[model samples]
Target: MSEKYLIGVDGSEQSRVALAWGLARATERGADVELLHVADDSFLSESVAFLSEAQKASEQMLNAEIEYARSLGFTGKITGNAVVGHPIAELEEASRSADLLVLGAHSGSRLAGSFFGTRAVKAAATAHCPVAVIPNNDANPNAAVVVGVDGSEASKKAIAFAAEEASFRGLALVAVYAWMPPLTPGLEYLWSEELVDSQRSAAEEAIAIGVAGLATRYPDLEIRREIVQAPPVAALVQAAEGAELVVVGSRGRGGLSRLLLGSVSHGVLQALPCPVIVTRA
Candidate 1:
């Protein structure tokens, strides 16, 4: 069966940008595109007429997005679904069978409650498959793909996904591990260069373990390692300045298993430098 890529669609220009990104990827992989538009019925009254009108509007939006995809020369199979429900919930449910879930990053609003903002992160955190959040702006054509690495199952999955992406795109792969020295508040004098070096060494080891066999798997892909003495989110954001894409795990080693999204992932999503893909094992 052909691979399926599900995308969340709104009538916004950001969603159109995401549609273009998704269609280009689908065309490359010969995958079917599934466009989903969910009208936010949570705030609407229970009146049947109101719900009917909302559903009708959603269908129109979905159809327009489908036409947009066709206009972009995506010749593969395309499917559209318009539903009246919470956008995040519907997208999460629809992503179960998809190979990837794509969403638009809202440029005008903060990521808390904005459409396709926090909602995109929320869907990415819980989606069964990987989720790609495409920004409205274009990526740097000459930059490599960056992936966050740590000695965690989630980061391992991210490394694999990022390596595959870089190989397919014929771009370099940058695996980054950011570490900060553990300093006690009252014992600031105890912090020294030796302790910092120890932390750096540990970070290096973790990153090495995270990308153990990628060289054999992707012989042609150029892989680079980045060990930064900073916070994970800040380091990743900096590394993504000129990156084509950024890949990060949903959760990290320090994050609790019950945490759907790690602090780093959430922070990266909030300040997305480029199109970010949150991967899951």
Candidate 2:
């Protein structure tokens, strides 16, 4: 596992919100925060050919973000650095060494507004450590912490991490499991209430098995389980309402099926009201 740290200030307003959240988390953990602004030379290669100028501006922004963090009573040390490369690649490389990578998701881009923005999607897909994608609207303090479990190794790791977070913050952990009836042509229309209930029960049982060990480890942590009959992505996004943090496994039993079925983690990270942590197995 990488060292515990939070990151912020990636040159977007959404990132500023993410920075604030990361700063608060770092303060709580008594850990350091690295304010990084990667200058993607490829993006501005033609517009701003001067690498030094871009680096200098990035450094200045990093310093300002660090100062803001300090003003917010984050006495923990803050380090600022600027690197020139592809934003996604550099961030992924940095995440290999950091405990957590926090990123801000912009709400204005229509492309991103509908799904995980390009940068956030790339980082989440490639990052080695947990990546927290923070939305701009999450400012509440009493929101619950939500996680999605599908009885996979990655989901199990996500549950363990989320349970620890909920225990540490004294917040409720809401575990969600999404189930759907088989899509066979005639079988699809044949769906019945009994089948739905049975599927939901099985999902709940799987969630219980996935969380049993963590619940034992954190006996005092408050947890709630939900089995929803919806697409995994939609179910997780809905559960993220009023949540301070959301956790999801990078890969699940669905496996390479993710390419065709889509990823619940990607969906939640794109639309969630709060930050999302994606854990790898």
Candidate 3:
């Protein structure tokens, strides 16, 4: 069977961007697209026919997107899925069997990210497969693909995904590793030069390891290595400036297994300027 990509569409403008992104990817990969719409009656009047009306409206919205996709020349099949439940819960359940879960992000202040309870963040945290969060605007195909790296299994997986995606897109791959300087109490003058050197050395080694073997796989692909002495989120987000897509690990080196998403991944998601794909093992 061919791969299937599931995308959430809520009739918002961001949803339109996500729909276009999903269809383009599906068309390129010759994979089918699943259009998911969750209708919550939270604010609707509690009438007898409200449930059916919600379901009908959701299906109609999905079909309209399908028609629009076809008009844009998408040849693959896009199945419509309508569900009545919490958006996050339904999307997470649907993403279990999907090859990828695609979502749209709202353009707003970063401070409102946590309180907004955006569906993209919550669903990406729980999805079994890789989750792609697309921005409100389209991407420039010529821009590079950026991947965050650390000496972790998740980072390794992200590296592989970023490499393959870069090769597929025929764009450069940028591997980024960040080191945070330690804060000491009033002993700044005593800080060792050797410690700084060692930290930079470790970051270099991590970049080399993360990008190992990609040169052979993609001979024509350009690879850029970046090592910055800053917080991981800051470094990765800065590297992702004007990038086509930013790929990151769901969890970092020291993240706990019980945590759905790592701190760095969440931070990058909040601050990144382009679309981000959060990969999991």
Candidate 4:
């Protein structure tokens, strides 16, 4: 139940696309929307007149985006803020009060949309709220909501978010849990059919237990479970081929200590087919 979203706007087509998505979600849930435009002062020219012009341009762009959203049938309360600061830090601090933060991927080919470049990734990793990275080429709005789940706290949070999204959109929820049975041990004694079957069964049970209460929470939402015996990143990317959205935990059970995002999540973010949400809780 995200009741508010803060979208970062930079006057780019991708940012406008993200605003559209955020506004649509806000309108659907009767939520409030906040548009934040961080005018990178570092990029501003040294002249005082140029600085004033840049500030005015940023504010006008924010206003224009709000008007554009309104024209597109968004009735939710829309507020705009044009500030002079670093975009990532500004967005991350502002995210503390917002239910979610929406950002746009860098402008480029659709295949490159998988990676949000530096700004999106920095804000997502440090934001206090969940971050939704919208790609530029999300032309088809109708696609299943896919989630990556494991028996971890972060994955459970992702499952809850994905389930709510599926329920709201009236779409099916595809829960994917990827596991790799130790098939690399070249010894025959270590690679048997029974062992692989047991591993698969355990993985399936984990997924079931992980999302046990989803049906009760979303009675009308359809839930589908898939167990992929491959690498987590590869399995998730393949599953998200035609999905409308992909959601995953920012980190997993064995996440690295140095980075905020785990290997699987990092890979999925870099190569998902559509918009991707990385949960912070």
Candidate 5:
């Protein structure tokens, strides 16, 4: 079966941006695109007439988005659907069968919350497959694909995904491993150069292990390594300054069982440096 990308559409400008990005990617990979619009009927559940009108409006919006996709010259198989339900629940359900879930995030000052006002984050955290979050603004035109690696099972999956994307796009791949000295709040006096160097060496080794056999797998791909002595979020956000796409694991080594999204993934999602793909293990 052809690959399928599920994109959430809400008639917002951000959603339009996501539609374009998803369609372009689908066209590139010869994949199908499914645009979904969920009309929240929570408030209007008691009013049958209002619910019906809202559903009609949602369908209209979907039709318009489909036309917009065609206008962008997307010739692949495209379908749109409108349903009455909670957006997050509907999207989560649909994403289970999709190869990818793509959403749009508002950029600049309008980012009051994470992409899609926390909905994107929730979807990404709970998605059964990979989730791609595209920002409203374009990424650096000449940058390579970037992936965060922490030698965890989840990050290993991210590395594979990033390598495949870079290979297919004919772009370089940057594997980043960020590490910081282990220090407690009141233990600044114990800080030493040796500790820093030890951490750096460990980071290098971790990254080396994380990217092992990648060259063998993607023989033609160019892979670059970056080891930064900073917080994972800061390091990744900086590395993504001009990145085409940033791929990260949904959970990291320090991830708690209660948290669906790791600190790194959640932080990176909030940063919105570029188009980010959060992959699951």
Candidate 6:
């Protein structure tokens, strides 16, 4: 297989951190790293004179990022490019041949991000390959790889991908299954111990089944499984606290009926503390 390609966007401080992380990861993987900065024409239409100046500044920023990557001991060849177009469309086009796309989350801007979602989310949903969203916070120390598995064919593919990543990075693979009580009419205020136990037991059994095949496929990799009783997105964010990377299926079996990506995967991508990888079926 060819060396993985790590692509990072340069826009904000969060993007800078993402570039640093991507550089570190690429160094470890012996992969090529590309730093891209998209100069949207719409962003510069207000001032015709400022447009040229802004483009020059953007080129400088890209050059600085490449120098920073080189300073970090990344001996592999690094390429820096600046393009003019819609940010999301440019990124999606650039990601066509990339092995992985890495992005950073805007810090303390939920409402703005929600009203006008970031380019990262759009690229992740539409990209042909996997996308990794890294948060702009303190770096995670542990090298654990957390993968969300729901027993769907797509999720099984995600599990296989996660296991391969864990093996390659020499990290522990954590397979997580989030389960909740089924909703029934007129049972809103009722608490049933039997129901809780049954759900927990079923979750454990399902996790066992999912991890068994991965364990056999990657015998040398260390694996751990967790059965959490909560929403998949919440459980995944909590599990991502100490994890280096989080993996999830692009869509689930239930969402297939409606031809939509699962809300869980979408939510996790927004709030996850570490990088997230979405695998296709």
The candidate maximizing lDDT is 1
**Per-model lDDT:** 0.86, 0.74, 0.81, 0.80, 0.86, 0.74
lDDT of 3: 0.81
Residue pairs in candidate 6 whose N, alpha carbon or C atoms collide under 3 angstroms? none
True lDDT of residue 206, candidate 1: 92
TM-score of each: 0.94, 0.87, 0.90, 0.87, 0.93, 0.83
How many residue pairs clash in all the candidates, one count each?
Answer: 0, 0, 0, 0, 0, 0
lDDT, candidate 1, 26-141, per-residue tens: 99889999999999998998999999999999999989988888888888999999999987778778988899999998643255366677788778877878999887776687
Instruction: Mark the regions of model 3 whose C-alpha exceeds 4 Å error after superposition.
Output: 41-48, 108-117, 252-260
Whichever of 1 and 2 has more lDDT, that candidate is 1
lDDT of 4: 0.80
Q: On a 0 to 100 scale, what is the lDDT of residue 124 in model 6?
A: 68
Off by over 4 Å in 2: 1-3, 43-49, 108-117, 189-197, 252-262
Report how far residue 108 has shifted in candidate 3, in Å.
Answer: 4.7
The alpha-carbon lDDT assigned to residue 47 of candidate 5 equals 80
Q: Which residue ranges in model 1 land beyond 4 Å of their true spot?
A: 252-260
**What shift in Å separates residue 88 of candidate 3 from its native position after superposition?**
1.0
Ranking of candidates on lDDT, top first: 1, 5, 3, 4, 2, 6
Write down the TM-score for model 1.
Answer: 0.94
Please report the TM-score between candidate 2 and the true structure: 0.87
Superposed on all Cα atoms, the candidates' RMSDs to the truth, in angstroms, are 2.3, 3.5, 2.8, 3.3, 2.4, 3.8
Where model 5 places Cα greater than 4 Å from the true spot, the runs are 109-115, 252-259
In candidate 6, what are the lDDT values of residues 31-71, reduced to their tens digit? 88777877767646757677777778779878877777777
